[model samples]
Target: MAPAATSQKISEKDDLDATIKKLASLKPIGHSSYTGEIKSGYSGSWAEKLPETTKARYARHGVDISKGYPYVPEVDKIPKFVNEAYAIRNEVYPYVERGAKADPEKKALFGAAKEVINLTKHLGTEIVGLQLSDLNDQQKDELALLVAERVVVFFRDQDLSPQKQLELGHYWGQVEVHPQVPRISEEFNGVSVIWQDYYRAKYGLHLSFKKAIGGNAQWHTDLVHELQPAGITHLHNDAIPSVGGDTLWASGYAAYDKLSPAFQKFLDGKTAIYRSAHQYVDPENPLKGPKYVEREHPIVRTHPATGWKFLFVNRSMTVRIVGLEPEESKTILEYLFSVYEKNLDIQVRFNWRPTKEGLGTSAIWDNRASQHFAVWDHEGKENRHGTRVTSLAEIPFFDENSKSQREALGLSLD
Candidate 1:
């Protein structure tokens, strides 16, 4: 059955159509890349031509100039998606399921599941049976509520296609289109290709990791530099290794609870600055090196759907506490980051190795309430790839009356 056509979906077709588009930047990494042509969510410009000196500068920064940019000359009519990264006219989608039902919806959704297992005490929940592609509006609504409560929900053996996944993302909210990175294809604009190896090679990053820890390996949420940020980000790993290639997620609410009452109060209203993964060159100061897209968000934010406060800082993007001194902010942030990094019970590690081809696992996470890290333990021997769609939510805000996840659920620490 086709999704109902509402006033919102005027020009949208049933599921959406796509033509094969071979991106120059993506052809090098064949199997893991998405080559479908689709509509773009935002308008961004890439340099068609640059001086040799400028090209050398970016190449030195680790870009593979030989493969060329992920330029679709037929689609974009330009040379590259590299050189300078900046997005304009990106539409922010308002979240729909705010204050949606909490109890009966969850009951109905879970009752339909063959076996529903909580992956961890504080957060992750894995549901077996029921294809994600067949979920009705009500089920989708309930699933949204469940994700807000669980932090991250998992589904195995789903036969969902990229088109179906993109449709699901639209139903959830406005899907985020990352202009800086190469996604699954042009046809599925909002769906991003989650390939660590693609990124590692793109920037000439080292591919060696023997369970190494700290630094960028620390906890992170997606697209913090966006004005509204990301809400529920869904990832379906179409390809996985036989061993290793796991992802670990930690509950932000629990991280906040790990703090004392006094400490929590201190962080309750604090705000922080976050940087984007893609850096842009300042045209005025091209030789000064690239600059990151930075945005500000509250340190402790309350989710509109859950009515709970969660620690909103991640070590990767989150740089400083707005109102503190350099050393003071650094000192406080280290301790707060430790609360998330050190906690075992608040975290859930998921291994994405699938038994069958179509039975690959999908993880739907509430980016507003949790942080996650993809383990590089696979070491590039096996191909691990996934397509991701992130829905934009409301600009993060804090409400003094909002309770923590544990406090709201009556789940005691003792």
Candidate 2:
């Protein structure tokens, strides 16, 4: 006779079955109705009151932040989700796990793509033929491998809705819900609103830690302070300007290769301090004012999927190298920052232009192995808006045996 089913396994299966039923019941929220502040930077306490212009802009999305959170008029209609959400993280079984072999021919991925254009030798790839929403299970797995290999991948003119986008996030891994961050709606807290103008207004003084040097500021990885930081991050820009707004991504793998063998040897296994973009008050020492969410991680960390070591430091969040004095750490950190910032050969600039098939474009990147900077050149004058979903992955680790991407692929720095 077969062994009796354990209660835990039986419970998980029951929950999974119930969750599937609930999802089937969830109808497509009207595209426009997908609007509102389920939560946001605007929802919290702030110093400078929101300008009427910003408030008016957000109100169009059903966000009446005028009174604060529970911002929607029909908050009662929004079903309580804390219990439902835990299933995705705890029981649904995280997919696209680390340490899997990559599919080089990309039979499943490019089999559907019309034109696979390599944006640069090291950094970006644009998969022209595929629609993100329509990807099958096999195609989705290949897509994750492609992102790891290319550092980032682009999709043009996709019809991915907010709900479908959130579903995709769940398929990848644990969808991160940062209660403090600005999101599209309460119904979908995982979908973060990426409105530059409004976000700038919300975080004033706190944004200063990201000061510029050689005009190289704001290059960062998401949620590095979390025990398990952001891994595969999808940013779908449903709205963009006619010209002037582009995002730049630097390949962490290429940055590692730029360093000499001696430098690479020194950096390997060394740890550095990374802090959160948000700050919180230290209750024990109220006199200190506020403190950032900080974590110490390897300066040179390995990407589990690719088994390659990449420089993990970012100019914005990674403040200092561990075990080093302040001045010593600053000097070394700045040099490493420049390695990522100054190397044009290791970077790709993507212009978010969309054809008639969709509203805008999407860029899905492996935040664990790349850093991106959004060009704010539009001066907040144009409609450059998007929603991002960041999936939390493994706590970072440095494997001394991991190879550099260039070395592993037999590609020269030249």
Candidate 3:
């Protein structure tokens, strides 16, 4: 009697499986599989497919469109949308200003400077009426803190000599010497000259028209190939073009924020190989034994001061994710690179203009939290020359307990 009952149950299970398979194989009625065309009997109303709760919510929002093909708000009701938008603006503006002013460190330098304007929500600040030489020890300390927190700080109309710029860099850390590039002069004390034409001729650093015209430009964090890359870079442009020589900086913290949680987790445990073979070369001796410097660093590094995680890879320096297949590395790196390149919301573009006193602009940026790209748009037209001093700091490290930029700043993830 037990064997008979088991056989009946098995037959019923087989019948149920066959019925399920048959249902799965069947196509929707009045829909053509080959042409993707709906027959005459099909109404093609997607609204009807929505759940009743969704329909009710839409109705509650005054979005009833069942009576007509296209839904439009009445003329009298259009003003409500405008009023709601203004209401949202009023609600949001204070929070933005509050976030901008939340960093109390800048207030320490309030007496030394005239104005401190935050260039963007996340990065870059321009300090007016403050010269490098004018800063006292306390003001310099506060300025260092501001630069570390803001990632980049700008100064206008300042008569800062090459010697003074080097001194400013030394205030933060040891002044870095370029591995390949030469110093400006023996008198200037470790200031590297970043003259466009001179470097192009001296180092054979030729720029192609194809590269300039290409819509996608590369960005880099300075000296990522070195074992200990530069931390704070002070670039004082002595000469710039009359027009069209702008530099863009993307926030590394914002770049980290753009990644999904799963992707971020995957990246946190990995290290990437950074190489600078193509970018830098010893011009005097072309056949140097070691052509480039290579270093491996964590894919996501934490800022020591801010206690925030930031994306460290750049389009120019980062070569491959270690331990991954070539194709897999290429696919992942390309996507990660695009997070900074494609998102303009997380970037700030600075257009260069000489001061009335004929002094060029000086910008100091933190290499760990920012990547910069110099737009070579003024080729053969104007000379864009500059002197830069890189200050050495701590080696890149990742702390698992560090909060993200958004988390640290109390910003919305959305």
Candidate 4:
């Protein structure tokens, strides 16, 4: 006999249809509808466009570029608790001057930089500290979009209990707590993510000898095995010292563009598989990682909103080159990984400092394109704790025209 009719299933289909119909009728949202499409040979001006969520997302959170500027964070003024970078806007004058001073190609690069992020903050910007009690609907929405654009942003001076940190994680997107470890707080059922040595010792977990290989530090987007791995990650540090232990970030745009034109063409459409490296996870400690948890991503991954490309492979978790011989794969990977590692100027180093109250801080970042390395520099008797919230975004794609257009607009690989 055929399976019995399920009312629940029919109801779900109805809901799906209604949502699809609404989306089908929707037009592109935001200035991106025009600016984004312009690079694709779309000719209609802004007036011809219909309202769209993409546009709204841009409108609500986009850096106001009409005034001509670049975003520079008011690092000195913003309080420790908020993401000071949120208040960043571009300063275009110097850029324009620099462009005018340079040759034509360098001038083009300066133009492209203008389109990078919101560049105006004359009225002053606010850095809202996030806590379970303080996260209102508007702030959550703003935080989500801000994360999607900047890839990573930071928050300092938070007094987050382990439980509260997990709660904050939930607001960002799906929570992927490490399986082996118990939750950090019994009340919140929160799990803590340990980095370096001190974090492992805090919970009576001994350091695995396998870490001697220094395997975990390889670069990768977080949790690629899940249908939706987190695109944004929140790492809260609880037991930080006065100095040392800086995290480094590399911009994918610069990474991809830094490649020679011939090499760029080679990877234009190629894909590679990324997985958890067995060496990084102690084989004896199954909880830390599986022998292999695999997913495939473009070697030249693009930023969804900006349409810029990044060299996606990192030293940490990327496993093998698809369809290549073992020797060929090793050679190619070695070349690619070198490019990823060698380009340091496109990267940023974040130094950790504790607040007067002794509570440390945390940062949220997009895992899809940006690569990060946590510096294990602190050496003391004290234990340190860091919690992260990882959010998800759509998978990667490439648009060459977007890259050229971005360059024309004054965006720089630097």
Candidate 5:
């Protein structure tokens, strides 16, 4: 018609569509050769053969050659610190090792030692935090004791930047990125647990079919399935809604203390099964499997540094008692979970306040003595985002009573 309408050549859109169709016919990105960052640390030949430059730097920096130039503190100058930590750690080691019941005095002592040890080791600051470098020695010590005893500490008007947050976490140990996902920025490393709506569009995936975690508002510990779960998690509410998104943390130390002596004895040496069913695996992201697994850990674990014992299971990961009858396991699990759920006085709930800059704030928590839950009561309306940086430490263990005595200043568990 119109000038005999010369056969329209493939338009740019059509060309793109055709090319996309051809590409889609082939294998996806999973088939592509993308060698991302290598998994390292635990084992590697290079670790034994430290780089010449690294060795030279250590020599120049007056670092101890024997300890592989790790950040081992100056123990000679602060012998009391070591004695306190080791003493506490030793006091409860047998209880954990021998599966012996915890006496009321021992339980109280462990709780007390846990606080004192944490305070002593963390340069006398509470909650094992190093955010406020300006803290005086007394303030730091007070913070440590408070955090050790209470298990959770609160902050008001703490204006922390993401960069500062990540930097501060380094004082503890190497930061651990999410094991299976390639989502957050690499430079920030494992500092972020990023979430967003436009992410699906950016990644070119179905929106409604998959969802991000925390978006649902669930109560669980962060990455408990890992052999060494996070010692601490710094979660800042970068984005929050107008109202109704609060996070709560319960004290495991308190939970253990609240138990009757008979119950405490019954839990000694008994191990429970913890599973990894709650970790969010995006279906569209097929790099990892959605399969779940269960792990057996002590019902009561002694803090390796503090020698204090705390109840270890939370509702999210704990599946069952490893050797108990099915009915017994179910009954016990329900009871333990209820202990954490019902105890409100020993918990702290944080309300998110939308900042003027439009980013929400954050809270840092000790995963060792605390369990957390995100309140999903506010979804759809408020845009909440988070970036969490996890820290690695020794597998939580306990110490003997003699060791516990040497750790504190004549402070007994009773």
Candidate 6:
């Protein structure tokens, strides 16, 4: 039987003629239209060239000059403080590991409401079966301490609304309202929306650009450009992609431990200038509406609750070290930045997945002790939206008397 014909009829011959005409009229788009030609030879200009004296200076500072000015050899020799820190990390890991992998009967409970499960040897821990509203005063205090020491804590299938999330943030400290960005809801001024679709449209950003300009695809501490940056950040992902969009956090304590004792001591007295570059409006434009603000903070800051020192400089916000020449600061800052970038063994990567009940994962991280990077690989595929509340805390300070994380954890130097 023949199918019923519609009022509009398609003609194959006419369509073929149109397609042929369009193809014949098409102009060639050269490669140079999108990208510049690649230069084969390097310019030997003084600014572009590495001087012998500069190479020697970097070599004296323990850099591998043969590889390059900023390169450091990956030697098996471990720093004494790093070894001690790891010994401490190993000792604490067993208790957390036992708790994480233990039977349901043997799991450690926090105030009869939550079971603690360590996510990594250092950094993150998952507190299962806990509601923000259900936590008592004692539990809230303990959770604050836990987050301070662990750097970040995770919760699954949380039923926390914006109001409850604000309340939970208040238990630790004052809920921070972002100075520049607006709130997710006008009624709930504390919560900030982190919707990818909204940001992409708002900022006119595209995924094709490889530069770390508009989006947060790089590791950073929250609002380091501010004098008193947010101390803690709690994010609740309501919608996520089927794959990718996982967040990775690196321990500032571990990053600090990887440095040599002499280098660490050198950095103790130094401060770095962190500027509001990527987050502020029109970072690249000099005449942008919002002006950029810069803040200077110690390269190594002590955790007030834990009394342990951790690396504070981040590649995203840190511009230069004070008291050094621009070139010298660039070389040194690049080296310090590589410590966090290269040390994957000291980091934890979390994969986010929502539960069957439509309740997604919520993460609370101590921004003072850790840096995080959002994987932006899920662009245009799915929606990744969330609400965040940042908590205000004290200014970053270093106490000379404070012990290293290793020393504070009671690990022997040997």
The numbered model that scores best in lDDT is 2
What overall lDDT, based on C-alpha atoms, would model 4 receive against the true structure?
0.48
On lDDT, who's better, 3 or 4? 3
Taking the candidates one at a time, how many backbone clashes does each contain? 6, 4, 0, 32, 27, 0
Question: Residue 3 of model 3: what lDDT?
Answer: 98
lDDT values, one for every candidate: 0.70, 0.71, 0.65, 0.48, 0.49, 0.62
lDDT rank, highest first?
2, 1, 3, 6, 5, 4
**Could you report the Cα RMSD, in angstroms, for every candidate shown?**
14.7, 12.9, 27.4, 19.7, 17.9, 23.5
Model 1 TM: 0.77
Model 4: number of backbone collisions: 32
Judge candidate 3 against the unseen true structure and give its global Cα lDDT, from 0 to 1. Answer: 0.65
Query: What TM-score, over all chains together, does every model reach?
Result: 0.77, 0.76, 0.70, 0.58, 0.56, 0.69
By TM-score, highest first, what's the ranking? 1, 2, 3, 6, 4, 5
Per-residue lDDT of candidate 4, residues 258-371 (tens digit): 777798888887878876321122223324321344567677766654455667777666677788888988898888777666766656667656444555566666676567
> What's the residue-level lDDT of 279 in candidate 4?
16
Misplaced by over 4 Å in model 2 are: 1-99, 201-217
lDDT of 5 by residue, 96-161 (tens): 111122242333333333232222222112222233333443443343334444554544233455
CA shift at 274, candidate 5, in angstroms?
1.8
lDDT string for model 2 (77-137, tens) is: 3222322222223333344563266466679778788999999876899999688989887
Q: Candidate 6: which stretches are off by over 4 Å?
A: 1-109, 208-214, 278-291, 412-414
- 116-206 per-residue lDDT for model 3 (tens digits): 8888987888888877877776676666667767888898776666667778777777676542344443344457756555434433445
Q: Provide the lowest-lDDT 10-residue window in model 6.
A: 91-100
lDDT of 6 at 28: 16
Q: For candidate 6, write residues 1-414 as lDDT tens digits.
A: 234333223464456556544432231111111112111111123112333332332344343324221111121121112122123212111111111222333222364654677877767888777776677665666666777778888887765566677887776666665422334333555677666564454334455436533355677787776556667789987666779888989888888888888988898869988865422122233133223356788888988777789998888778899999999999998998888878887688887775544566788888987888888877646767666898767676888887777767776434
In angstroms, the error of model 5 at 253 is: 1.2
